[model samples]
Target chain A: MNRLTALVIAFALLLFAPARALDIQLTSGDWQPINIFVELFLGEENLNGQIPSDIIADDLTVSGNFRAYKENQNHANAMSAERLGDIRNRGGEYLITGTVNNKSGKQYTLSFTLYDTLTNDKIGSYSIVFNNENQRLVAHNVSNWIYETILSKAGIFHTKVAYVVRHEDGTNELKVADYDGHNRLVMLTSQDHIISPTWTANGNSLLYVSFEQNKPVIYQQSLLTGERSIVANFKGSNSAPAASPDNRTIAAALTEHGGLQQIYLLSGNRKARLRESKGIDTEPVFSPDSKHLAFISDESGSPQIYQFNLDDNKTRRLTFGSRYNVSPDYSAQGDVLTLVRRDENGDNISILDIRNGDTIPLTNTASTNSPSFAPNGDVISFIDDRNKKNLATVSVNGKVIVFWRDSEQGEIINPSWSPIKSDWF
Target chain B: MKKQNFASLATIFFALVLTGCAASKGAYSGNIEDDRSGEAGLAPVSAGTAGKASSPGFVKSSTIDDERTSTDSLLQKRIIYFDYDKSAVRDEALPILHTHAEFLNNKGGAIGIVLGGHADNRGSNEYNLALGQRRANAVRDIFLSYGASANDIEAISFGEEQPRAQGDNESAWQENRRVEIRYTDE
Candidate 1:
């Protein structure tokens, strides 16, 4: 029992110690569903409520990654070490348990803890004060926090939505709301019709079409300030106006004398026609590099999106699956193009791969139009008509997030995301 | 003495009846007699007179009504087509433009009108919107030069938002690429 025995014992302990430390690296395929259990501590009585648990679980599941479980809370008051060990042994990598204390008539303080089951260590915790009305949003915020801590990426929880709301007087009103469709405010209002509210290079300003004088005019207004001004005025119909990445020029469809719609560049006060064709040409979107413009035209006898190089002026058709495709909005990254593809069944928002020319349907709902990519390009927002009600920011994934919803305000159409907001404009 | 008086009365009655019949026939024909030449065989002073006569009296009565109806029905000569991305009033549209100019000059501040410039459904919404503005400005310029005040008129471009015809055909597009003069108060 001397120096030799002590050295052997030290080496044996070092070998087993490293194995006891658990550090699981999850992949896209290897990732498992996180099971969450919540117990509302309202004093001594443990209230059995599925509302908060279901809401939180639903929020996580919508990310298309998590599969939530519903378990009985037999030992709600006693969440002992032995019980937690049993939950981890059952292949649950993560566990969430929270307590909600009602402070006032409708207000409540929710304190939650997220645990990494493998290490039995508290990875993250959140305490939010909210009312009954904001329970859904609070749940989403907590879920987002957990997602970011676990995935090491920010979730799209705090993003807002932009959409068009039609009034009873047949006037279109541009509106902005939170991602969950709360705190809605009208951005643009006119007695005449308004359509296609596109976010400027800066997310603070919105570029949209207004028929105040009976002609469609593109106007830019600040979301923070109500100040508005005319950006471009072209001949014939000017419907779709997309701002370039630099935010200096706007790519628009201008109708010339030959009765053909052509793409034009309107920068400051100078105007130059970009693409000229005998057939109908419209819907111009600038690539991320600001060197190419993706637009729609009937040059091929049917409406299809075409990408035109700003330098070489060579044009190539981007969409081939549908005979009709319009309303092309380039993503912030300029990798994918979000547009509306119409067929016999009606219209649906689709994402087109610029490299492969393959189109993937983003929204299955018919009559989904004016699909726009968020500045981050992780989510696509569009207008959808459901049960005769126009809903803005109808996500392809059933996130039920909205910037505005006025069931009685009439139909909402044409939603465009603002460009990333800059300090200049 | 009695026979001479009766013969004079008969002569007077015949003259009055003949004059009345001639005047009625001229008015019923719906042709404005030329100030230079009072010839019935000559063409109507303006195509407007012929249009009025062709469509019976029971039809609409406004001067612009007959012209609009006639132009709308006869599509071939009515629509003045344009080149790609040009808002300049074409040679064919000169006559109509002149008519509008004259109306603007005569009416002046008495009427407030909006020129709704439209584009065919072919371009992006913003491009069409700006293009519509250019078209509207073109018409507004013509009206202003003809004596209409800029304040009395507003030019708006409805870039490809509203279409007169739905089809993506040449005919439909021709109808869409137009700057319509809409009067707020007539």
Candidate 2:
């Protein structure tokens, strides 16, 4: 092309580029959650068929990437092209059709087929043979498999979330539930208060701080046995225990020596100080790589989030925009840090991009704090007390907010989402 | 008619009760301006004036003098509120803390008191616990300077776990950030 024509084309492209960008921004985002319809199971002789369907529906809906609903039909054959056309006509993007059949001798077969309504493509089909007791677990595994197959992302349906709930009588209990806040089982209950429940790297154990003995002591509880062992019983306070990803050491705030709270790495009976100051330092969380620690400190006149390095022991402030920022935890990738920020209005949870130090507010509610990220880094669970103290999960992109409202007088305060069950599931 | 009759009946009953329970010649519920602080402590003793042993050289009744004792209600006003994220003693709470310090001093360290510190649910629980401890320590330091012994003081912090107020507003939060003085004997 000649120079004049090329220059004209370049100018036109520049002029149209911004307009296209604006149009893309204005339209319904392509990431808009897919509408999912889960069909009921057809073959079930020994167990209820709808249980598997509900599990899949809940798994997809809670992921924040899909909107799920139960379909009217109960046949696996309903996922054919003709049936899928009707689903697409009804604004369904994905169709999940399945069947649950009793094979014999307390064994059952559960299967599901995923279909793309728009393209009429059979994405994948999965099946599992599970014992009677593991019926619910089989459903969860199938949901995760369907999620990973369709969304190209790992699913957290099989994960567990442990949180401390304060009852009306001023007692506290450490409770664990499925990702959707279902199948809840109390792990520990104390007449005193308990705060900050975090999962160990194995995902089968928990590390939490409890005031069961009238003093704060960090304890480790096994999910399998319901037994707890004292992890840290320091003099002043032992609180905010964050288990390292390697499971070798725990970084917690201790006032054992000098009567001032500071971050320390506790392995067995030995502790190496991570950070020291006259000011208060607590809620120490490890980075995803376990190379650094971020905790709350008031050395700069107000409580703020600070990061201390492991290699050089250099301490640096990570939050500056807000006067009050605390209760910090990291994403699975360690690129984003979620913390509570306070302004004139009230306290709200926000995410800080560690790479650029850009903080983004995640919730507009008055008091939301103690955010812990899902293992996939897609959502962060925090506590807010607007109506009452309850556990809430917010999508990383700030699009979805799911409050675990099903709890009975649930005054859930401190929450930590368990890591991905990749080692088992 | 029943309400009016009940009101008059309640009035007559209250008048009789107040007259019997009044520690002074004035009204039963003394105003803050009553300045009869010592007289208020007598009502809590519940022992009638006739129970005291009359000894020689005690010409005047012990309760006859202008003795003032903090009333039960006044002594129970032990909560001291501080500003947000602050541990310093407020101006309004200084006199109350002073009264406590003097009571400790006059006892000559015979009695011990525990200062329970607390903070609002604004920050992390551990930080709030630390701040609450600092507030209690601030009170402990003030009490120590006023001749209160270190042995007579035990400071503990509950942080934001226990809140006196339940809302998310500043009014509730202000009440939650406080230090309460609890005598060990009680």
TM-score of candidate 2 on Cα atoms, chains taken together: 0.74
Best by DockQ: 1
TM-score of chain A of each: 0.73, 0.85
Q: Which predicted model would earn the best lDDT?
A: 2
lDDT of 1 by residue, B42-120 (tens): 1111111111111011112245533334544321232344555677887677666667656555654544555667788
Report the error of model 1 at residue A39, Å.
Answer: 6.3
> TM-score per candidate, in order?
0.61, 0.74
lDDT of 1 at A169: 65
lDDT of 1 by residue, A1-425 (tens): 33344335434533553221111111232333444433333231212212455445544544434544434353434556776676665555666777777888867887777777678788877678876656656766786787678766556554556676656665655676554444455655555567777666656677776665344556776554444555654433555677887879887665534255577788876889885686667777788888999887776767788899888989998888677787887876787888888766778887888999878776666666667776656556666645335454433333333333454557666655544334521
Docking class of 1: incorrect
Q: How large is the C-alpha RMSD of every model relative to the true structure?
A: 21.8, 17.6
